[model samples]
Target: QEELAKKQAEALKIQKKNDELRAREEQRHLAKNTRVFELPLSRYKRKDDLKDIAACLGLDLNGKIPELTSRIKAHLDSNSVLQANPRFCGLFG
Candidate 1:
């Protein structure tokens, strides 16, 4: 009975150590893959700056800006041409 208890205690310790190692490895992997950006859009001088940033992050910026801008203006204008609105407001909002 004593030998069986000793074996069970050793197994528990080994399992605990393995769990700790796995957690540490996962934390390191997450830190390596995560990215954070800190900047206000108003700080950018031109629309191309946004595209360049996206490109640097391995994102496809082609045609996305035009589509996004048009969609936003369409929403704000309610599909009417009579409304006078800013072209870059949608980009910032």
Candidate 2:
């Protein structure tokens, strides 16, 4: 009984470690495939154009211009492109 319990605990620990590794790999894969775009704030001036772009990008603007702006800001904050391009800040602001 003691040996069986030890084996079971060891198996569970290995499974947990494997699951964590798999999750980390998936996160890296997703990050690699993610595309970042720089959208001009002027696009928002035209509601229809903004909506069209958001739809094409699979973003849910939901007719809310402010929410779209926020999403753009959030993406830029986490992405490297924004750091490399000062012009992007001006364009989006």
Q: Write the per-residue lDDT of candidate 2 for residues 1-93, one digit (tens) a residue.
A: 999999999999999999997885555445433424355655555554454444434556565677776665566556646556643444454
Worst 10 residues of 1 by lDDT: 82-91
Best by lDDT: 2
Q: Give lDDT tens digits, candidate 1, residues 1-93.
A: 999999999999999999997885565445433423234334544445554434333444456656433443444345344132232333343
TM-score of each: 0.36, 0.37
Q: Relative to the true structure, how large is the alpha-carbon lDDT of every model?
A: 0.49, 0.57
TM-score of 1: 0.36
Clashing pairs in 2: none
Error of 2 at 46 (Å): 45
